[model samples]
Target: MIHKQVVNHRQIAWLVGSLLMTGMMISFLRSVVQVARMDAWFSQILPIFYALFIAYVLSGLVEAYPGKNIFEILFIIGGKWIGGAINLLILFYIWIILAIDIKGAADFLHISLLPTTPLEVILLVFVLLMMYYGKTSLEVAARVNEFYFPLYFIMCISLYFLLVNEYNVERLEPILTSSLDRIVVSNFLPVGVYGDIFLIGAFLHAIVEPRLFFAAMKHGVIIVGFGTTIMLLVLLGVMGFMIASRLNFPIYILVQQIHVTDFLDRVEMILFSVWFPAFTIKVIVAYLAFLVGVGTFGGQRHYNTFNAPCGWFIVVSSIFGFPNVAHIDQFISYSLPLIVLVFQLPLAIFLLIHVRRKNKGREQSLIPEGTKLYRFYRSMVWITTVCLSGCVIVILIGDFFKDKSAVGGIATAIVFIALLLIALLTSYGEMQALNHGKQKLGRAKQAGSFRQ
Candidate 1:
């Protein structure tokens, strides 16, 4: 068995966030934009929900059976024959994906950077890196993710923030114009990308505190999910869905417009430098997970033993797997979602069926509505309600000012802003009233005690 690594919750969370950044920009963005159009930003909601639920369920299962990962759980719960079959299936899935990731990274680097360098050369270098990663401990891999995620995060955010000038809010003007069926379909499109978080099941054994594994996974996923949501919006907000959807990598082209100063013109390379590592780390994590799973399943050989052989195998398969960019793109765009669901649904059902059920009420009581997470969501809920209400009011009252002139537009803007402010003030007033009431009750109780 591979040694347990002392990785903290925060560090692993960063790994999850880092793993997601590259995939979102390169692959996940354009596909959703094509289907959802203006509403593509909200498509992240489905995957986020699904991913978190999977995390919660998987973690709960991990906690129930201490020290054992889901793969091992399959064996214990089902015994060798049946469990081994399922285990092999999951391993097979991971191996296919790991190979695909290696190829995808090579393809990306070849097209974006070392065009003069042969593809096989790039593939060789990448496979060697994965071989090194596979041979290393989980702690080492986590540290690499820790370092790269922030650099990737800052580069993407800074470049996008600078593009505020280019963002035409009108590009996102007509919301939910797409049919209901289209919106639901678009939501499922990104599931394949996000469902990779299920690989967290492989990561459970490495965590220093396995109990908090789900918490770290959830936080990490939230960062990715929200970040991805904002990224899609920005892509649509700056470049209309028409333009955003057409490009294979909208974010790359989007960053090309980042000519901050005369000297800093064409700094997409800077962003690319950060993003390349970001993408590579994602592959490393997936590769490492596969290796770790392999190590545990055998109980005899070290995971590192397979790393070189498997890495070379992947190198060859990757070259063949992605015959061209279009082939991989088609596979990812269409085939991937089905594969994700096939793996995800069965695993989830199996865990839910077999996992040790903890005290439901006790668990619910632990995270009261007053907690930071719940409060933040409550505040967001209120804000969304107020904004949506304001929009509806504007639409309803907007008919009165039928002149589609500058005056009418200004009036609509003013009305929307006014209603939004009023709603916010009312919510604020309610909060103050509740606080005042609590303070008054405290004083009254003090006086009553003093008299006694």
Candidate 2:
């Protein structure tokens, strides 16, 4: 059995924020422009639901599994073969996420802040830090997260002071406008950004008291979501829709725009400083998730040995993941949400249902065949599938409705469709493969026992 260790409540909370919120805000600021255009601030109002929903699902998992981390729960519900498959996919996901973060940080610094430094140098430095932290236990990472989270928050809140002249409440209005569909679509930005919260489930084993896990998880998730929404709203208010949507690094740009005085013109540098701690937290979270994944499936007794190799692998994969920065932006804006919703939520739901079934001493459950709760969950499965299907349809329709003669518009649409299809196919294939492996294992075990 893996040993349990203590992490402070404050660190756990920051762990959630740094993992999902910090670097995400950079991407979120850039992507929100796709739907809301000049009304990006207005679109953000919808994510309160998305953020809360994600937290609720994660918290539910903690309640269902109690002391188990994500990998242990996967093993229990899916069985070893299937569970291992799912676990590996999660590992792949974390690795890819880390790559994106690395590339993004490198690109931002190279173009916006540091032109002389090579991309490789930036990436290597970041990965080195992540590797160092990854070697430590989850408890240490959590404490570090706790320490840095406040500094990151201070940097974000400092925006209000620096950009007071830029704030225009009127930029928030011309509200709603029969654009409910657009508003929901806009949710893709923050949803993709915030989906990293699921990684926190990997740390559940570190908490000794099973009952306290869910409460702590819920508290962390809700607080992080609340903080992100407020920060995004404040950013919109300070930058206005015009500038915020156009820039690749809206938050960074807003900080650069800060001119409290002539000498203070370079206050934007402080953002870079604060971003290090935030990024550090994010890297550690991804590293931990990847470590859990490898340890589950690769027969490794310890996770430290794989950290260096995994870091290098992530760097190489990230460079090839996107043909260019534009493609990365398009993927995040147009396709990432469907992947998160379909792949993540279903896994969590299956785990929760499986645990609940096992705890009730039934292979299935004792719920009446057509009980309300059963029916509701059944409906939810179908609804989720149908809603995701509709998202695909709507995206296609939007592409068809666009002016085809415009070369740039057509190119963007093609890239968008291709990326979405790739993500969907990959997620579906992994989930199916994992489930199938579990079923086969159960049958094999039964047959072996019969022969005996």
Candidate 3:
């Protein structure tokens, strides 16, 4: 058996910070702008709720499986064929995420930072940095997170202070009047943005304790959610929702409104400095996930060999994914539900169920015990499932048939998501039962060995 390396607590904390903030920076706010127009900030409630539910369920699944990463769990649940199929889906999802990260970074820089810099050069630097870091182990990634988070947090706080003068409460005054339907229908932006938290399951085996899974995730979500809500509020208040939605970098636009006297007119640069590192961490995380998925799915060998090819694929695919930024914007707005259903939800439910079933047979005979923290995690699946189900229900109700002009199609979408969430939860509940039994047996075996 291959020895599994463990990441330390500090690094794990950083990893969580990097992942959470990365979600905030990449597509969440921008996607919201594309949908609800001036009302995008307010419209985010539905998607935020949905994304949180998905995050909880995804974390719960990782908790239930103990030492298995998502790929191994897939195989256990569906056998080779079905599991392979699910893996393939995950592979594609990772690919898309990497592509988006690359493109978003390059695009943001080109539009805002170094306007004349070649896009290839910008993307190449990022890809190389990620490739170097990706090979360094999860410990390295986490270490970087811990090292940089202080500076990152400080810069973020300073940014808020710099821009505080620009806020306008009148802009957010008419929060709910945009035809409740329109406000609801526009929430796909945040949903698409935050739902990527599901990808963290790829690292379940790499973390110290699976029980800490939800703890880390819940903390991250609250941070991102609350931070985002505040940022959006600031954006709406400062720039007015109409103007805020019109700017490509809503944050940048807000930064420009800063007036801490004429001396600090270029505060946007400071914001970019803070924002750039956060963005780098996002790309790094995506690249790391891609490398791991390749290694895990390719029979657990040659991770380094796969890095260059995967990086190149991210480069090429990003260039080809959309004709231009407009298309990317449109896709983020309308195609989100399809992406969530086909990729995030199905895979999560499948893996959770698969693990539970396999755990059932192990109830009779067990081997050396794993971590105690991991066992506590396997027990929490039912509680998580119930909470997640309720959250999903709220999202569906809030967002369902939100397109008043296109009520029929919207209702269909709502019903479909509801059905998917239910199926996933029921399937996962069964798997949790099996996983719990396996843990019990394993404990028994350990106890007998101790007596001997």
Candidate closest to the true structure, highest lDDT:
1
Q: For model 2, how does the per-residue alpha-carbon lDDT over 1-452 read when each residue is reduced to its tens digit? A: 13445664446556766876677655556677557654343333234345435555554555566666778877887788898789877876676677777777778777877799987788788778878877877877777667677788767656766677877755544333325466556666667667777777777666543323333443444445445544555666776566666777777766677778766657767667877777877877787778767776665546877778887887778878864566667666666666677787677667666656545642232122344534543454344334334444544454454444344333433443343333333333333332343344467578862110
Best of the two (2, 3) by TM-score: 3
TM-score of each: 0.79, 0.74, 0.74
Taken over the whole model, the C-alpha lDDT of each candidate is 0.68, 0.61, 0.60
Better of 1 and 3 by TM-score: 1
**Would you list the rank order by TM-score, best first?**
1, 3, 2
Tens digits of per-residue lDDT for model 1, 419-443: 4444434433333333343344467
Model 2 bad stretches (over 4 Å): 1-4, 42-67, 359-452
Q: What is the lDDT of residue 353 in candidate 3?
A: 65
Worst 10 residues of 1 by lDDT: 359-368
